[model samples]
Target: MPEGPSVRKFHRLVSPFVGQQVVKTGGSSKKLNPAGFQSLWLQDTQVHGKKLFLRFDPDEEIVSPGNNPLSEPLQKEWKEEAGHHQEVSEQSSRSPGGDDAVPSGGDGLRCLWGDTPAGGAERWLQVSFGLFGSIWGNEFSRAKKANKRGDWRDPVPRLVLHFGGGGFLAFYNCQMVWSSSSPVVRPTSDILSEKFHRGQALEALGREQPVCYTLLDQRYFSGLGNIIKNEALFRAGIHPLSPGSLLGLPRLKALVDHVVAFSAGWLRGKFQGRQQHTQIYQKEWCPAGHQVVKEALGPPGGFQRLTWWCPQCQPRLSLDEPEQVAPSSGARAPSTQSLALEGP
Candidate 1:
């Protein structure tokens, strides 16, 4: 599953499509009818934790040929190619005021060309990605080579958005649903948000649950996943199974700080097209030359996720023992505190 940083990257990739009209729609998603999205304007794009939201508003008129943003040659090629492959829907031919018309609203539409009239109902699509889910802009995933059985393997996009500007967006292995209400996102709890409240995250880490379990709780630490949990704990030299309440306030603060810093660093690496170097997540040894321990850890009756840590570096703490902060030899990353102040 993609973490917060990965989701934010997807948000950035799809942001440019905002204000483009959906010339056509195709995909294998049974949960959403793509036909209704045709002619709707891509009003806004937002990311909240592991989810992405796209707002589409109904327009009274479609993009005229004279006003089309794509150049004449490119627009002609797209129309010719799209006509051959794209799914032709009955709703595509219907007038904007027809019975299946989507509702529209005035707020959030930022047109790419000029002013757009907005009064009809607006629709929101909430996208939740599964493991290995991804979004491709202006392209489709290539078909894989045949397997041992000589069976050709080709994956269909879950949602495909063909824009009027001759570009398209393809989504794979993701869930799409039309939402009636705005998505509820708490910026203060989101790890990637500028409004991330360190004090609040520290308080959440003080719960009685296992530290690893608390770290994965989206209610408190939005955008955090198993990867961030493992790496941050290793960097902070904290045991995964230790009770958060047993960890002293200072220790909890350190864990929070590491989480924020690591998330920001990970996002930065993604933007720079650099691969992330893991300390102990799937490694056999820790940076301090100690054998890493791998085991599933979670709260009772909760989901157990695989976690890695070095026993020598992250010694388990007992309730009776005095709190001791282990020295971390892990490489330091840029802190997110300054980034948060600068705003997202």
Candidate 2:
């Protein structure tokens, strides 16, 4: 799945479409009838963690069916599919925050459209990318090479939006839903946000859980994923399985600082089109020439994720040992790169 940085990049890609009217819509999504979005103007775009939100408002100038270029058969299909759905306003009213608005049963196609709001009230489309999901602008994804079976074809976009300016956006392998409210609860929790609260992150880290599992918790560190978790832990010279309670305040502060620095640096590198070199993630050796260990570490009965660390560099800590921070050879002096880029 695309992490926060990657999702932020996607937001940038689709930002230009804001204020543009949807001239046409086409996609293979059985859940969402793309035709429902036709004639709507994109109001704004936002990113929270791994999710993208697009606000759309109805355009005043409605296009008549005679003038629309969409084929009649396709239009008929859209009407038929859209008929069975309820209004988004009705669904959202029953489930505030739009969290449970999507029905757990049926085809899972909880698409619902309502009458256009009277005073330019906006409807939102929330996008959540699956693993390997992505969005593209003015182009479709190219087809992969044929395998031994000698079969290959262009990938079908899960959703396509043709804009009035002749440009278009394509979504592949992503979940799109009509939402009534913004999903973000605490904006400051996002690592990339300008208001990211380091103290809050430290407080959350103080919980009695494996540092690895706690780091992955979205409630505390929005937009943080496995890559950031692994790299940040390595840079701080902390083992993944170390209990947060065992890690002292100083060490916890160091870990928090490293996470912010690394996340900002990684995002900066991405903006400059530079690839960040991994010091320990998926590596055979650490910078100090210590062999790296890879294991799936997590709380008992919880989902386990692969973690890589140098045993010599990031030794497992126990309550018996006096608190001592290890120096990571991979560590650098505290950076100001994070200050350079203001959060979105």
lDDT of each: 0.66, 0.67
Q: Over the stretch 1-344, how does candidate 2's per-residue lDDT look in tens digits?
A: 56676776677677767778999889887777788778888877777666677777785433222111112121122211100111111011110112311223333433544333335545667787766677888777765566356756666777899999899998887777765443333556677666667777888888777788888877678778778899889888888888888888988887877777777676555656667777888899988898889898766766677889988888888778627656666655456544432332
How displaced is residue 310 in candidate 1, in Å? 1.0
Residue 152 CA displacement from its true place in model 1, Å: 5.4
Candidate 1 yields a Cα-based lDDT of 0.66
Tens digit per residue, CA lDDT, model 1, 110-144: 21222222466555676766766777777776655
Which ten residues in a row are the worst by lDDT in model 1?
92-101
